[model samples]
Target: MSKPLSPSSSYDLHPSVAYVQSILANLEARTGRTLEAWVALARAEGPSDGKARVVWLKAQGLGASQAGLVAQRAAAGPGHAFDDTPAGYLAAAPGYVEAQYGGKKAALHPLFERIVELARSLGPEVKICPCETIVPFYRNHVFAEVKPFASRLDLGLALGDPAAVADLSGRLKDTGGFRKKDRITHKLELTGVADLDLALAWLRRAYGRDLKA
Candidate 1:
């Protein structure tokens, strides 16, 4: 099941925020330093380059992933806060689909909006969240995502096995498949609302497989 949303985080209602909090909570025990401590060190009591900070963190015994997270958050600079809700994220996140659609891709907004409407109607158990750069629809786990581009939208579905869904080959793009992960194994290009209807059947299939009733 999706984890319960946090009530104390900067972006308490955002799944990403909760996920980040969980990661941070384990940082002190895993690396002997809290996120705050690492950020301060990244600042180096003055200022330091990202590569230099990562190197220093590595010297202090942190693995590549841990050091990278620390270096990234540190390099992000101060006051980098997440929105408290999906709506806010949609409105504020850089390169949000709506922003992309509203800007150079205005002609694509109606199509994306239609897709979102259909996705939101999936079921009561589903959560439609706007993450930093993507709109993810989740059941107990993420089953699909709608990623918009300057020209079109990429509809991602977490269908369990690619071979079993061969009938869907005409619409699937090879680029987004996660062969080893299996889930989110297909991506379909969406150019208009007419595309949503065709995608719904597979979306339901993905939801059925990835999300338990």
Candidate 2:
């Protein structure tokens, strides 16, 4: 059998893992209840549906983010949801990135790495969270995401309203909407390392905006 996860286990040193740990570490202080306490409370009396559970938790005094986290853990139950532990999530993070770059999209891995490196270089607070299809970079909130394709990678930026900025006009393709709070208002396609400079420029602007937000 696999070893049990320990809170003190040596976790992946990625900034994203650290970022999540920071949130877990601060849960009690922020919500006046420990994660286990919140999970127990949620499972015992919270609504069965996830969205409703978040709303219910918020009514019980938890903030939006905290409520969501608690609801997610409760919904995933004990062994799932990355084993409902930081160590489990950290241990699984590398596999998540590997899966994203596997097979025909393998060639885009290097480009993705360059983008992540440049994004990380923007500041110490940048956190890289990898999902199944995209790797999101966060600063207070999600400022950017790198989505890979067989031939190119799309760098999505949360630049508020691209049209309102004259220099950004006609420079980026809209990814649907540019609402002020949209996590991804625009996308820049990158086919090679040559695109890194332009990506970094826009990334820096997005990162700065997130800092102020």
Candidate 3:
């Protein structure tokens, strides 16, 4: 028999823009990673401490705050809110803080700076997330258009070296179904179904129910 989804359950999506949102939502819940916690940690603790925490994260084979961003949501308490009604009241609108401040002061040794910086080198598409980065799990792709795919490999491996991004491109390539890079509109590389499920599975494994799914 086929193995059941471990920690991750299959999502019911309509294969449209809503599908991307669904995948991101599912991914955030499945993984315990969240931007809220990362931001709070960075803001409260000194940069050294933030970097130390990132070291711990790297040891685990993921970037510090980037993992949560890749999953597209914050860690679920303070810095961001889930997309669900009533709950999302906590999450900030995109760039609201930045616009209010009207400037970004660079830090020489910010905690998650490196992790987030390296992530920028990886994804071809990055946009200000309409949702919590921890939940969406990666910066939203600015697609001139969106496309549908059966799996996540094409986007993850688009930059040539899959290792430059996530670790599993080679592995995901062996999937039972063939994936495509179908383009729609300007063809932004927004995610569809598979990656979201993977993120969700990863989340369930990380949080172990200490946090909500």
Candidate 4:
């Protein structure tokens, strides 16, 4: 069987100010991934980068729970909505990986799992790509056989782990689902993102639309 991906993780500093800043700094230092650009939606100050950093610092200071609040606060102008579309636009996201071997995917598998679990628990389904690399590894794996959309985007794996189908009950939508449902597969699945993190982050971002319920 194909080996399983690594573990998952969450932020203790997520819901706090001081801690989150420190954590974000660490995230940036290790992977150079941060919400640095989000800080510019509101009124501009003298130093543009500093303004972005301060807005982020404030958001972190308020804590992870307050992140959405921070998003709202920063989006002060007309019809501002935190511009979440960037998350989907990986081709353009900062630190976004065009291929699998990116460090963020390798280092943060555990964190990705947590995000996936949260999204799956909230709503929508998860599908792990049943790629040539993965299918040979799993024996009892079940997939909802739909046509392939992307040349590289088909296949389903058990959500939490390749072996834990019953426990996690999740699938990654490789085909982007049929017309009624929209599937936004994470390209990192094939990339070198730690398998677990790639799966988790993909689930969170792909299924993010259904999270509200």
User: Using alpha carbons, what is the TM-score of model 3?
Assistant: 0.20
Off by over 4 Å in 3: 1-48, 63-91, 94-213
Model 1 per-residue lDDT tens digits across residues 1-213: 123233121111346656555666688998888877987877775247878778888887877767767777778663323413345553454344445556677787666556655655666667666554566778788888888787788888887666676753488765445666655777888886567777777778777777465
Q: On residues 67-180, what C-alpha lDDT tens digit does candidate 3 reach at each position?
A: 443323323334333333332332343232223223232121121122223333333333223232221223223221111233211222122222333434333332221133
Please report how far candidate 3 places residue 46 from its true position, in Å: 14
> What TM-score number comes out for model 4?
0.18
- What are the clash counts of all predictions, listed in order? 1, 0, 31, 27
Best by TM-score: 1
- Candidate 4 has an lDDT of 0.32
**Full candidate order by TM-score, most accurate first:** 1, 2, 3, 4
Candidate 1: give the clashing pairs. Answer: 158-184
Whichever of 1 and 3 has more TM-score, that candidate is 1
Screening candidate 2 with a backbone cut-off below 3 angstroms (N, C-alpha, C), the clashing residue pairs are none
Task: Write the residue-wise lDDT of candidate 4 on 32-123 in tens digits.
Answer: 33445434432343223434535564554434433443354445443221223322222222122112313443443333333334333423
Candidate 2, poorest ten consecutive residues by summed lDDT: 1-10
TM-score of each: 0.71, 0.64, 0.20, 0.18
List the candidate 2 regions with Cα displacement exceeding 4 Å: 1-83, 167-171
Model 4 bad stretches (over 4 Å): 1-43, 46-83, 86-97, 102-124, 127-213
C-alpha lDDT of all candidate models, in order: 0.66, 0.75, 0.30, 0.32
Model 4 Cα displacement at 87 (Å)?
Answer: 9.8
Best by lDDT: 2
Better of 3 and 4 by TM-score: 3
Worst 10 contiguous positions by lDDT, candidate 1:
3-12
In model 1, what is the error at residue 27, expressed in angstroms? 5.4
